[model samples]
Target chain A: MSARTLLRVLPPVVLLALLAYLPYLSFSVPGVLPGRVNGPGSMQLLATCLVFAGFALSYDVVFGRTGLLSFGHALFIAAGSYLLTVSLADWSMPLPLAVLVALGGTTLLALVVGAVALRVGGIAFAMVTLAFAQAASIIVLRDPAGVTGGEEGKALARDAVPELLVGVANAPYRYWLALGFLVVALVLVRLLVRSRAGHAMAAVRENESRAAVLGLSVYRVKLLALVVGSFLGGLGGVVHALVLGGSGPHLTTAEFTLSLLVMVVLGGAGSTWGAVVGGFLYHYADARLTEASGSGVLDALPGVLQSVLAQPLFVLGAFFVVVVYFAPSGLTGLGGRLVRKGVRT
Target chain B: MSDLVLVLVTGLGLGALYFLAASGLSLVYGLMGVLNFAHGSFMTAGAYAAWLTMDALPGSMAVGLRLLVAAVVAVLVGAAVGVLAEAVLIRPLYRHHIQQVLVTVGLSLASVAAVQGIWGSDPHPVAKPALLAGTVEVLGARLPVDRFLYLAVALALYGGLLALLERTRLGLVIRAGVENRTMVQALGIDVRRTFTVVFGLGGAVAALAGVLYSQYAGTVSPLQGGSLLIYAFIVVVIGGMGSLTGTAVAAMAVGLVQQLANYYAASGIGDLSVVLLLALVLLLRPSSLKGAAA
Candidate 1:
């Protein structure tokens, strides 16, 4: 890529960089809340958004790049989280070590899943991936007594060290950590997308028959993407568990799974910034809509509406429709269109 | 012997219900080649429609009346969906498989949300006909009257669908359309209209499943569509994609597998185990299924 092309992408990249360091700004400035962020709940929301942004990106790898729509990628995330919890909480391994284990574990699992699920393309790919995910989730749900903690998830005891991390356990500190992870994830993904493997994936997705005629191993590219996608999913899951402090069968639920995918669609698949922005917007509604109050009696409205909108599945579903219908290219596409209009004007 | 009979009967009953839904999904995918993700959402809608009707109608005739109401509503709703979907999404991406798949997925999400916006997400209880609620002892096996009724409905619907496909002019067009859409169009019948009819039939069949699902599950929640929609995809894949016979056999297999697995793995990993089985079956028999189709 030329400097001129990079120049066009710089604005959004720089803007995200600033957002990443927001926690540092808050911490250096004034009184800040511990664990909760901003001395208020704002920081908590930011961290939440960043973590899931990581998740949506993973889905983007498969759905956006590979053009494979998987209804069950949550399997890898839940797998990573449990592995992390067992490592750090029950066994008391170092946090960094646990995260590494999670990465490797999920990567291996993805490899196995991808090997078989990628055997065919089209609807078969979607169905088989979903079957794998649902199967894993059911197994976890059934084991209520053991690893999953059943319907009730198990909690990780915050270790002393990452003692520095523990000391700065405020929202801002957590924000920077998550941001660091996000940058690493993005850079790695960017590098991968530029690799020969990524080109192969694009080729396979374009026209499998032609790609096969050209002697490209279609299944190999898919397997690579699936494994990489799963690795990212597992990493995101670790961050999510670290943020939430516990794990449960909620991992098996469709609500969050669909929401994560919806975020990918909303942000525009195949774009890094799209996933980030989509994640922020999703968390905004998640945190704010449930807590929104207008009038004096609005305070009571949250209590009542909270139960009704307790699940954002409907909203996410609506977003999926709207995004796919109007903005097929997603927010990224919309951005491209806006830029074109501005240039013309 | 009696216990075995009970399990088999109940499994058949459940399997029949699934067939009602999967048949529609398979038909839509076969003709259009777009995997309709929203099939489940319609099922959820049909369940609610049937529930509301049964609840409103007077006793002694509520069951029959609700069935009539649900079947009509299901067909109409399915037709409306077919028309709207064909006009907006389907018509544009006639040959583009990826676009068609993504559009239907979007439609599925939209429909599910629309249903939620209208009805909310709470589970709604659907009452079976009071006349058929009692249990009957047949051949030493105790079975609910509704189960027998479901089996009967399933047989009738399948027979009717088979006959219509084999004997009717519309069926001939659809079959011709599936075999070669361009050729069918060249033959002078509007292939698009043929698609519309197929969509309507698919939707109506889905509705029938929803009616039965509500009564069998005892509660039809807002999640019914998304929930059942996933199963439709699974059933279709296992059923050999575009084959009607494949769809029926696959649904029965899935239903019976659900029962037998529930019996054995009931304590832990039962449900997951079944899904795992689905995954394994595909991985091993990839050729026998999609392989044949390709």
Candidate 2:
């Protein structure tokens, strides 16, 4: 290949090599967990976030590109998760099969949800999706006596072996797995957003009336957007179930719900990488805040707030207010501004 | 039959609470177009205030004194929130709807944290005044006197608000401002002052609801405001934002529907009935229910 072609493929080629060689260190190092580093709990959390990154990206596509606020994207995740679990339990399906089923199931679910949600544009979509999410969550929470394992959650019976996944069997391995999916998902999203579909979605979001007058099928475009969004959401669930080893109803925690929204807003909502980067920043900050509480330095924050400010939610709450009140463009937007100014100079 | 009646009364009482809680929210939406998610947080704040003051007061105070104390505390706190939020947070986003949404979301987050920090994440209980705590026989059934009291307080507040909106010069300015803010401002009237006044009034009403609900439930959870805000948004959309009568009517209907739903459907599907009703409403009369907001 020419030097130009070589340069284009070099980064991903290098990354592949690095991942292949990472297993060597796990065995060579004395204290490392034989083939990987990092514990299970965190591996699961990080993995879930990585999968959520795809969901967020799809959301950014619709929200930023189409001005369609869909709060029920959570339903897609739930649907995908349930499908994966059932496939594993009933069919003893391999992970790939499970993922395939989940993607198809979620895409179909997305079609249904989008059918109703897209019927009305703007705020109406948001309300409908929100209502759907609430109803779906309640259903999941209620089915505990049998299929769902209820509040307890169900785990996949099949084991994920090291040989099955480049011969590593821990969270660090799972983290790499998750990171791999996230990278691919991110690249795909970036490509899609640069395509004609992306332009059409943007056209509709910016001005539906104009797009309609131009003869673009607004409804069809919206359907495709939501379907893509749902597919990503399900794919995320597949990786989430694989890396985390378990799933449940409470997975729809308020913190996760609120934080996901905050992350999208914080990262400036539109860009693909913004979703991934925002996920990391938000989850990391939240984890750190919870751990750091009562450590005397920040203890004063909660202690002084008449003893009620000690919770990590307070920190999140404060962050929300500051950002909303002051930085409407979000951190990514600010970064974009700085970059623009620097280039101009 | 008795159980049905019980659910009906309970739902109506809770609906009044919801309506009262939503009053400030709708008003804020009307005057400023801000959703005021923090309206629920303000209710928690008022509840906390009432609890704090109750603890501070040693002897048993009269019912009137307690109500006065709670109302005053709510009004003062509400006014502070209104002014500070308007000046520092919301003022910058004036007429910019997107910024208004972002800032309000942030404000809600901040308020939740502030309250949690002050009260601890643990639930705080507010004691009902002894006079209001006991129940009375009404319509051949034993009823929680406080429920009727809330209903009474809500009606009184509504009456007073209607009078204020209709009879006073401030009211005329507000009405004129809501219909056409630019026209009033162009006529040399101070719109900023009007915005501030309406915001303060909205906050006060929300705080009052918070205090009343707290004493009635005898507990304040952090999620109190957050969850309440969700229902209020639905109710407002249903009732038509900025329509006082619409808010009251929608609030009661939702209250009854949800309460009855909770009574019959297993805890799992209890919330479903309301959602189903809302869905039906949306399907049939989407525009009429949500009014102009959607």
Candidate 3:
């Protein structure tokens, strides 16, 4: 590759490598870090972070690249989780087979949801997707038949997962699988965004009317993006189920959708690497913040102040508001600006 | 037959609550073009406001009279908060839909946290004023008087709103504003101030609904507003954006469907059916029920 191309690819390649080895690295040098870091626990955290990275990147393809703000994106993820878990729990399907079925089911669902949602653009499209998501979540919660496991959620059958990928002893194996999933997601999304179809998606995002005027099939480009995005999102959910051993109704909530949106937006929308970075940072901060809030660090503070600090959701909400207002482009955007300014100087 | 009547009445009661919650949302979206996600938080605030009012007042007053006082206080407080929210959070971000969505959703999250911090996570029981707590015989069927009261208020508000829009000058300005904000602004009216009033009115109306529903249900919870927000959005979606009559009609339809669905299906099916209805409507009419907002 040329110097320019190598430079462009270097950051994400490095990020992927770092994320893949984060758990082992953090565990090996435990005392070097300020906080407590149990070996297996850190491995699980890295695995969880990789799953969300995939999910956030999938969302960015549609929302950031295609300019489609869908509130029901979680529907695809939740569908994957439910489909995989149910197949594993009920039929004791092999893990790989279950993943394939889930990926297929979610892609088809994306087609149906996209067909309905893409009829209207902008805010209306968002509302429609949200409605669908709400309905889907309710169905999962109600579990009309015995399929979804209702509110309790279905778990992966012990026999379904390979013994090598099952317990705390298998944390490293799970981490590697999760890392593999993230790498696949990142590489595919990067390749897609650099292609002609990606250009068409960017065109639609920039100006749908103009794209239509230019004889480009705006709807088709959008639907294609949605399908790809949903497919990757479903893949992420499968990884989540694998890493966590189960999934719950909360995965389908509007809150979950909003959190994904926050991740993409915070990492810098429209940038593939931004999604990965944002996903990792957000998941890490969320896990750490939840821990910090309950820790003895806040005991000396006043009651109200301490309580506010203790509630991580409140902090996350405040962070979201601040990020949107001040740094609309997100951390990656900030980095880009700094780099450009440095070159100018 | 009696069971059907009871279900219908229950539907109407729920519809009234939906209407009260949705009317302001429709008004704000119509005039300002901002979907206030914090609209439910306003309702929650109103419920708390009512609770505060009731707790502060003397216990010797008649139950009906006390509730009346509480409702008035809640409306005033709700309107104040609405105006404050518009002026602070919403005013700066007008015409920026994505930012508006983010800020409002954030505001709602913060509001929920604040409420939890203040009231704790536990649901608080709000006793129905003794007078309306009892049931009255209507056509030889005993029904909670409060249900009729809720229905009556919703109808009265709906009628009053219709009259305001059709017969009053302010309504004419608002309608014109919705149709073409620039043209209305060219006519030299302070459209911005008008928006402030519409927002406050919406907030006040939502609060009133919150307070009334809380009393009827005999409970108030901080998280109740979050769920109600979805129902209100569905109502606004099914009812064409910027159409008051459409909002009223859609709200009632949703309320009735929810009640009937719950009666027939499993526990959570009522909510699902409402969502399915929204999706169905969006599919059938891509823009809205009446193709009002482009």
Candidate 4:
């Protein structure tokens, strides 16, 4: 193809190739990774990050693309995880069938919630979705019929999972599975954004009245984005369950959904790579900050200061505020600006 | 019959608490199109401030006198924090509604985490005065005396707020600002100053709610404000965002529904029933909530 197209294509291919080859690497980044790059601990952390990156992208479909500020996205993700686990352990369903059931269930949930929430536009829609998510969170915490395990969380049934994906020794396989998930999520989001409905969503986000005047069905477009985004979020939840070996009530919280919003905003909303990078960086920093909290550097500080630094959310939240003030478009947008300045120079 | 009275009185007490928490939030949202997610953090800070004040007081001092001082300190701290948040974090991002909400979200997360870090996540048992801890007989039902205090305080706040809105010039500006901020601004009124005042007012009231809530629960924790915040949010939405009267009415309904449901049906069913109430409200009258959009 042309030089411009080649340049655009080259970076992602190289990045993907590097990620695919990460399992064979033996190098360790002492403070960053828990072990060698290929080791189970690092692999598990990386895999989790990838799953979140995909999760954040799913959220972007609504918040970033369609400008729909939903506070209940966590419900779908939790649904994917809890459903798959419950199906495997309780219903004795096969692994493949369980995954399908989880995805299907999440889609149905999105449809119902989206339809109800979209009844009132603007901030009202956000409140409605939040109420639904809160309801789900309460149900999960209650753990009725002894299914959810309440605060303790539900562990994956080893008998249901394949031998190749079951143990710590097989971390590389799970890592690969997570990478595949991210790829599929990326491709699907790319396709959707380029579709006719995607255009409608964009139009609706810009001006609802104008878009409606232009003969675009605003409600349908919004519902489409919610369903697709939630469906992908469910897929992330399934992968998250596999990577973590369980489903916790943490996934069903309003805070979890807020963090997704933070990630998308931090990475640069409405951009494919921005959401992914935001999610990956956010999860990585959260993990590493906890590790760093115990490191000697922070220990040397006074008691109160040390305690403040120890909390990952405190640091991330402060950083997010700074980002919102100084870098409104997020890291990618900032990077784009610097790149443009460099080219001009 | 006694149980019903207990439940009803307790529910009203709880509703009073919700009203206190939601009033500031509703006013802020009504006037300034910002959802103020950090409103809970304001409450938490106020609670902690009061707790710290009480803990620092001399043991020989009368507990009742110390609590009064603590309440005063909490209200001041809350108002100061509210004003600072408005001036520093919110004022700069004028007209950027989404960013304002996002900043508040970040502030809430950070503030709560900071509190957890400094104090640890464990709940601190609050020192209640003898009068507050004791039970009083009402219609053959012995109820905690704190419920009555909550009701009294809430009624007073409600009355004060109504008078302020109905009589004061600042109240007139706030009311007009909520209806058409641009036109008010066009009239050469510095609506921004009013935003700060409303935030300060919200903070002070929310702080009072925090202190009262800690007394009700007999403990103060970092997450206390957040948990109460969800119900407050539900109250705000159900009451119709920005309408003080609506918030007061909705708060009572939610509080009564929750207490009655928990007592009559199941423990967690009350929380679920409140959510159902929100859904039912949305389905029945979507236009009521449409006023929230600036």
Best-performing candidate as measured by TM-score: 4
Best by DockQ: 4
Two-chain complex of model 2, DockQ on C-alpha atoms against the true structure = 0.45
**DockQ versus reference, model 4:** 0.81
> Clashing residue pairs, candidate 3?
none
lDDT values, one for every candidate: 0.72, 0.70, 0.84, 0.93
Q: Residues A111-144, candidate 2: write the lDDT tens digits.
A: 8778766666554455566666777776676774
Ranking by lDDT: 4, 3, 1, 2
TM-score of candidate 3 against the unseen true structure:
0.94
How well does candidate 2 score on lDDT at residue A203? Answer: 91
Q: What CAPRI-style quality would you assign to candidate 1?
A: acceptable
Better structure of 2 and 3 per DockQ? 3
| C-alpha RMSD by candidate, in order | 4.0, 4.2, 2.4, 1.3
Greater-TM-score candidate between 1 and 2: 1
Candidate 3 Cα errors over 4 Å, as ranges: A26-38, B265-267, B287-294
**Which model is ahead, 1 or 3, in terms of DockQ?**
3
Clashes per prediction? 6, 12, 0, 0
Q: Report how far off residue B120 is in candidate 2 (Å).
A: 2.5
